[model samples]
Target: MAVPQFQHLAGRVWVCPGDPDPEAVQAGVAVVADERGSVLIDAGQSPTHAREIQAALTAAGLPQPRWLVYTHHHWDHVWGACAWPGVEIVGHETAVPLLRTEAARPWSHHYLDEQVRANPRLGPSFRARARAMDSWADFAVLPPTRTFADVDELPVGVGLRHVGGGHAPDSTIVLVPDSGVMLLGDCYYPPPAHLRRPDDGLDLVLVRRLLQDDYLWYVSSHAEPMTAEQARSAVETT
Candidate 1:
């Protein structure tokens, strides 16, 4: 896939579109900025993906991002943390232990191959992506520098809210109230296909919340921004 570019969505918000490459699935990265500096939504899938964000920001003439926030602990969401050294990383409190466990283990091409062999979730496609990366020399999960349970307010009035969903119990959304934009990571997506089926009840509950909240634009990790009408239909049909 071509390197994704950040498209301006609303006040102080821009998002790099997600990659559809199955072997290297990548989530969209959102940037919220003002005089306080920019805060990135998710760090992308790998160093190459993160650097794509960096290059896009530079090309757009935006300042370096000041913070990196994980919407959850999924590999595609948090594995790119090493690319943002010194950037304050934030995540839901539930993510700390999950990440720490991975941090304690050794990661190598062989280790990854073995993981794919032993873990159904990390299937053949995951192994393919691991082998495709230009390098894994700098890959590592740096646990969040700070974490919160329910809600955490950041500079520029951005709000990080933990609204755990079926895809991930630590799922969170980035709320840019002033701009009426909400960034929904993988929260609305169904659990991985190999995992237990999605909970329809849970999906409905979150969909209701999104509709009631009525954000002007809803950004999901794997798709383009949506209008209220579009967002509602998108989630309901999922």
Candidate 2:
């Protein structure tokens, strides 16, 4: 398989490509930096993906993240956070309790078994990576050191808004006002009528409101960054 490449969105924002496994549900990691420090929008799917993200940051001459902001409590987005020690992890308040759930258990062989069964072709690789991730003591739930009730501001000039929908309950949207870039973790996805849940209608409305602000670039977890206009249309229509 070809090596994944990190794409630069704009001013101090770069995205590390995610897993290419057809059965994998990983999200790309977004690295943002400023004079204050750096922040990661989300850690990738596994320990391997996290290592790749770290390498990419070093290659890009960016500092280690002082903060890891989770978009939500999904395994694909927050599992790799254990790789970054001493970094203050941040997320919405709802995510705190969710992180402590049995589902977040790193060493749970049952979870790995289920994944392997779900993707038989990639089962061996998935099991191998799971074993590696489980080996880390810190691999267990690395709950957010800092939690926000609604909206919060980071020193890097990015705003974390609790959009509250999509794939998870604690869904968040990251807005970098200075860079005019918005990182919409898994909050937004392309067409597939079934993917559009009725419960997320309000969330879509909230996303539309944020997109009304001055933004040039819109980055989603699973797809290439799109222009502000394209993003707005996607949010409004889908």
Candidate 3:
């Protein structure tokens, strides 16, 4: 339904669009940008979403992404990463082992067909977009050009830490300390706030141990932004 959309947060963090069910309120991409460039939390469902993310990066005075972090190995989150150039993909160590080298899996193969079978409630060009995700030309993802087993924190400019794992086994969260914000790739969505289906929440015990108080802004790849308190609270509920 109209390509996709992006939502801004505190004027720095942002979320882009994806192959979300048109009626769902929670679909799309979640992006984290700082002075260095932009780091998309999730690349989104299809390759077509690259333009939407590129526009956001441009508006923020950045170039094509220098880095990207996938929340997990799900096709919706990692498959479209090929759209951004010169990016050093980063994710958990196990991530690579889980994804397919080919996009011919039953789940992905059929899911695209589902879109085609359902036809244009998605406004104009929905079928064309669906075909793109199915075609290899649209995306050639690399789950994580760089990986971390336990933890790997890098300088994302503005004194921040891009943390990895602890969520679906490959989740990553980027934290900006001075601003008290943590750009969670996919580790922090509440049990059922997803723009798509139910993924429940993540490992509260391990996740709790991983978090530091310096984090204040907790932005999920699925839901809107949150606070440290909100992060703690949500974890407790889980």
Candidate 4:
């Protein structure tokens, strides 16, 4: 499949579509540009993916991001951060320790293959997704430089809120008031299959809370943007 290009969402927001292909998974990356500069929603899966996003932005004549925000500490959302050298990274307070833990992991190809050999249920899926990139030699997980508790408001009218959910305890949601859009970073998805645990109603609760907002569009990391009603229906049915 051809690499997806960043599509304009609304206002200053643009998104590069994510792929769910089992052989290689990728989370969508987005950017919100303002007079000050631009704030990137997620860094993507690898240096290659990050560069794809950069090329798309350059093709569209958009400015390089001034800040990079991780919606969570998930590998898919953060591994590409190293590509954006000087950009200040931000995440939820709970994500700090999680990222530190990730930074300590061995991301080499051999280590990943070993993990698959040790753990069957989860390892194969993980290894398959990691295959998205040709090399893991340059892979590094960079922790966020700035952390926030509940909400952090940026000068560009972008808001970051730490709303933990079933998918990840450090999950966060980004609100772009300028575009009336909310970026949902795998926050409503149920826990991984290996966890063997239910959301325990967290999905509905979070969806209800989110619907109270004035967002016109909700974009999940792995799926296309949705309407407020569509989000509500998705959560209720799931």
The top-ranked prediction according to TM-score is 4
Give model 3 RMSD, 1 decimal: 6.2
Q: Mind giving the per-residue lDDT tens digits that candidate 2 earns over 30-134?
A: 888765778889977766678878887877777888889999887778778878877899999999888888344545567668866876754654564564464
Instruction: Note the Cα lDDT for every prediction shown.
Output: 0.81, 0.75, 0.58, 0.83
lDDT of 3 by residue, 138-233 (tens): 456565778777656656652223344334555555555555666655554333222224554465665687567776666655555667788788
TM values, all candidates: 0.91, 0.81, 0.67, 0.92
CA deviation > 4 Å runs, candidate 4: 198-202, 235-238
Q: Write the per-residue lDDT of candidate 4 for residues 1-238, one digit (tens) a residue.
A: 5665878899989888877664466788899977597999999888888888888888878889999999998878988898888899999988889889988987777777777778876674577556756777667789899889999988788899988987888898999987889998889777765674653444667777787567889988888789888877877787
Minimum summed lDDT over a 10-residue window in model 3 is located at 188-197
lDDT of 1 at 115: 79
lDDT leader: 4
Residue 74 of model 2, lDDT score = 70
Task: For each of the candidates, give the backbone clash count.
Answer: 0, 0, 6, 0
- lDDT per residue as tens, model 1, 1-238: 7867878898888888877765556677889977677889998778777888889988887777788889999877877778887799999999999999978877777777787788877675466557546686867778888999999988768899999988888999999988889998988777765575545333666866766464798888887788888877766786
Models ranked on lDDT: 4, 1, 2, 3
CA RMSD, predictions in order: 2.2, 4.4, 6.2, 2.1
